[model samples]
Target: MEELVLYGTLAAAGASGPRNPQKMKSGQQNHNNSSIVVCDLHSGTPYQTFKNVSLPRGSTLQAVHATSDRVFSVQHNSSVLLVYHWGRDSAVQTIVLPEKLAVVKVSPSGNWLIGGAQTGRIYIWEVMSGNLVAVREKHYQEVTVIEFGRDDDSFVFTGSKDSTVLGWRLYDLVNSGECQPVYSWNKVHSLEITGVRLGYGLRNVYTSSLDNTLRCWDLERNELVSTYILPEKIKAIAMDPSERAVYAGLINGDIIIVNRYKLNPTTGMVEGPKGNNEKVTLTYQDNSDILLTRPDSDTKASVTCLDISFDGTVLAAGYSDGQAYTWDITTKQVLRKLAPQKEAVSSIQIVSRSRKVIPGGIKLTGNNSNMLAKKKNDTSAEIFKLPIFKRILDEKEIENHNVWVKLADAPKQEVDDLAQVKVKMAKFLHEPRFIASAKVSKSNVAALTGRVKELEAQLQRAKDLKQAKEMM
Candidate 1:
């Protein structure tokens, strides 16, 4: 069981803001220490680094995502999306977008890629076909967050600075000529939305806003489920795998953990906390919520990003101070402290490693010639390449897109092949053994027909003799 953590920085300390277009354009020429680092979780040593001439000196906040085989990141203040493979040092493909994207997310199945642009427009693309499926402007301001439902990949949830969250079905966006959201919730928060998370079955959606509130909505009912008010602005949010607890990162460098269920003494069963418009307000003095702080109290760097491990036992957090920390959930202790970047940590991801297993363990003998020969002789290894995305969608390409359908089970039938049957018969006649067997069968059938005819004649004569005896 091995895991790797990938993280990138915003910009070097004392550098200009990432939104400066002039600075971003000159990033490639300048000698900036900008790279995506992949390191081991247990040990803080970086094992792989993705650096190339095409990557920007600064990356936008939460603009990075990793799939099983590729890594995706957006360039700050630019319309470029850098894609890198696992073992490649440079970007394999640089996707040119119509506008600069604030955030991007790859679908769980790795078939679709969706991004929210600075102009509040959403762009969706087919990963394999390189087709721009949809480009729509729905938000009034810059799009901040984009997420796909874990249980249902076709369901997408997006939030923006307009203080709205919209739910969409992927199929509708791709197939329909004019697409609309399945559900839209507007004016839920007074300020811009910062983070969004979907609960089990995609029925419950949790969102955090700068208005110092964490609101949960019931997608099925299209209503607000619960709201947790915090003292300070919420910068980032994450949930455990079980959805039993929610974690909110504050601007004051405090991580608050809230439990969704409470124990009922009378019933002796756990029940969800009742929702009210003005009931729940979490404060620093409240003992109901747990607070996690950095070791150094003087450092008040806000948490920029947060991600929980697959097992829900560890929490990875990145901060404005360019540090990433892994915390043990149960013990509430820091497992590792990694601060390799000089700028703010914008993204963090924890992914399991993929390994290839051999049928039997290789022997470690002194003779290494066999291993070298096997490696030289192996030609089945394939180099994984990222598909080059088309900037503009072509009508012809869309019309030619292949549609997939699942065929139902039916009775199987052999194909009729008259020519093949004739060829087989000709071969059978040409064979000496088959010809002898055929002759024997033909002679046996003729003899049996003659014998039957003789038996019929004998029966007729016996009947005549019986009739003569009767007359006498």
Candidate 2:
């Protein structure tokens, strides 16, 4: 059993999803540890959990949003936004805003991040630098939802509790640093807007509101395309890839499927089959044409959030009672169910890519500055100790002495005794090599005199020998 426990710990540490452009397959922020849990969709297993992530004081983890390789979470009633990357135990970046945030979203290209505050302000940031690109006070109440343009990252749509939805060009927001909304629709809903989604071609923006209506607006013309009135309050909405269906999660714990191409109320159903067409109008507590009914665990719990998988084949729904269900979109069968927390599940996201494990942990640690400081400290103790002014004086004096020595052999002009004394004094400052060379020359002269005396003595000895030979 001890060995098994160790094995499980190791598996949890290394078992990650994929490292592609899509950062996560599915993720949620649960009550346990107030952490973000990433799960593998194929295996329906928990891949990794980010723990002890930093949030604002007195705040809980309210939402989890992801970019290509980073996961961001916003805190409830707090201005702090926690950023999580692979292999990090704590938030790598904590972006603090002026006010507390209620919702957050990352762009499809992973270049921008946006957070909506309860103060009716939306803050936009460039992801790479964490620079605040723009802040707009476009809503009168709390901002509820922020969504990127599905076709491209050029535009972003936001819905607010003020019952308005505004669209803005991302380029203008970052470049001009202005909070202007390019397109504005006032009082689109009679109540607070809960969720917003942009179509694949960006031709329509779908929004659900507390007023119990799913409204679609055309982007190019900035006009209403259609409205599907539901019986119960719509809490969240998600669209499939084909743009053929829009799924609405209701407050009564029911999921409703609305055909995207069909069911225009003003005009009769025209494009789709007659049998497929259902009544576009809904009454209170109606589940007659619901797509997915409530599970036994979440019988009357409000569906708080909903997400569609990348392939549009799976639907993941989170409930206020903390039940999370994954369903096959085609068969409307529950594939898996989980309850990670006893509290409400604030958000749910379904992505396509696997997990990314960032090697060597965090990339920012003041390492360069630390190395520079160490190098400075090591060299500060060993100074050159150079003689400053005194050394320059010594060099100048030596140069003068050298000039005196070089002029020693020149013809001496007639001068006074005092001048001659000054000349000798100047010569005294010359290098010692002059005195050394003079002593060496005198020693050679004495050696030559001794050799001559020895030669004379030898010549006298030879003469004395010659006289003795003559006497014989």
Candidate 3:
């Protein structure tokens, strides 16, 4: 099996003081721990860390996303975005935003970056051009989660504290300048949504809320498919790649695995879980079928984030206590426990190792010596660097922008002039004038054939006459 890595972010120590009084006193200055831990998922040992020295002293909630070559993170309670290269320990670039973002997500193609702000406004930026394409506000409360569809970057789903989930088409935002959402579901959850995940082909969506319920929505029909009511408030949720199971992280340090399909006893066919309201209550007793408790059960730490591997065999869970755990999906047991951070673990992601490679098949060795030397030697190359993001969309710049497309030469093919003529003739056959002309040509051909036959007969008679004259 290929080794998987986990990227985790820790919240500021005093950021959650108002929410949890036991952690810290209210009105305390939030301490910044602007670092991301990259660890081996199987062994739970960290090998690399990325830090930003210039970020303000604050927290980072679930605002971390990584691409093939870079990691994007936002400074919670501040209007700062940090972009880091995999090989660099420090951030490569720091972007200052106009407003504080609650969550940020990168599109699957890495061509677009979007952030949901505390004011319920969503901003999108084109990665290569660094142009702000769209900035729209539709939610009434703070945006909590932003998720692009699985393997599909054209569609985005956003959940807010107003208990509404809206889906937007990326093309409309970028090209048409229409910031309206394609679909909006407002009455599904009564409380604020915490997590949002899309199913395969973007057909279904799964969301968890603080209302103690996990709801599934069918995007094709725009209707609610199923709702599972849990005992505790659901804080985080992750779905497997195959969509066979859903893992919900609760506030009480418990993880609930709800199987979407179960075998029927009579027909042996896979069917959904059957019950009125789908009420699933967690207990400490012998019902180990769906519950996975934290190792330190005595301590009540909320599960802040959850992510599953691409293969769906491993699950990574992050807690408010700054601890991270890896679990085996088949056995429902803890595979490894990572070292705790100084504060709460705000976000966790399970990604493959291949994503760490740079564009030129060069794996990042975490050595900045070569980069420093290259930068010092080549000042002209800096001119081609990506432009800084603009705060507002520039209509004049867009009108003057030019797009260049490199088209490959098509393969050479031999052309038949007679075939071309025949095709042209075939196309005109349906015309009235052509039809009449075709009939005239056919009659003329028949008359010419008859004339040729008559001439041949006359020629034979002449030969016979010449033979007779010669005999006489």
Tens digits of per-residue lDDT, candidate 3, 82-177, equal: 666655556555566667677888898877889888888988887766678778889998888899987878799988999999999888877744
Best candidate, TM-score: 1
User: Where does candidate 2 clash, by residue pair?
Assistant: 17-354, 17-355, 18-354, 18-355
Ranking of all predicted structures according to lDDT, beginning with the best and ending with the worst: 1, 3, 2
- Best-to-worst order by TM-score is 1, 3, 2
Per-residue alpha-carbon lDDT of candidate 1 for residues 1-472, written as tens digits (9 for 90 to 100): 5677888777454433244333332113223555678877767676677773222232234588887677888765467777766666665455667777888899988888898888889888887677787887788888888888876687998889889988888898777378889889787798888888987688788889999999888787887878899889998899988889899989898899977887899999999967554347888885633888888758989988888888888888888887888888998888888755766778888877674322122111222211211123343332333344656767787778743322333656665798779879899889999877667576888999999999999999999999999999
Q: Please estimate how well model 2 matches the true structure, expressed as its whole-model Cα lDDT.
A: 0.62
lDDT of 2 at 148: 86
TM-score of 2: 0.64
Model 1 TM-score relative to the real fold: 0.75
Candidate 2: list runs displaced more than 4 Å: 1-33, 53-62, 87-89, 177-179, 262-279, 283-289, 354-356, 359-364, 367-472
TM-score of each: 0.75, 0.64, 0.73
**Model 1, C-alpha of 48: deviation from truth (Å):** 1.9
lDDT, candidate 2, 65-134, per-residue tens: 7654566766543455556664455555444445567777878876667777777777766554434546
Candidate number that wins on lDDT, 1 or 2: 1
Model 2 worst lDDT window (10 residues): 1-10
TM-score-best of 1 and 3 = 1
| Predictions in order: lDDT | 0.74, 0.62, 0.72
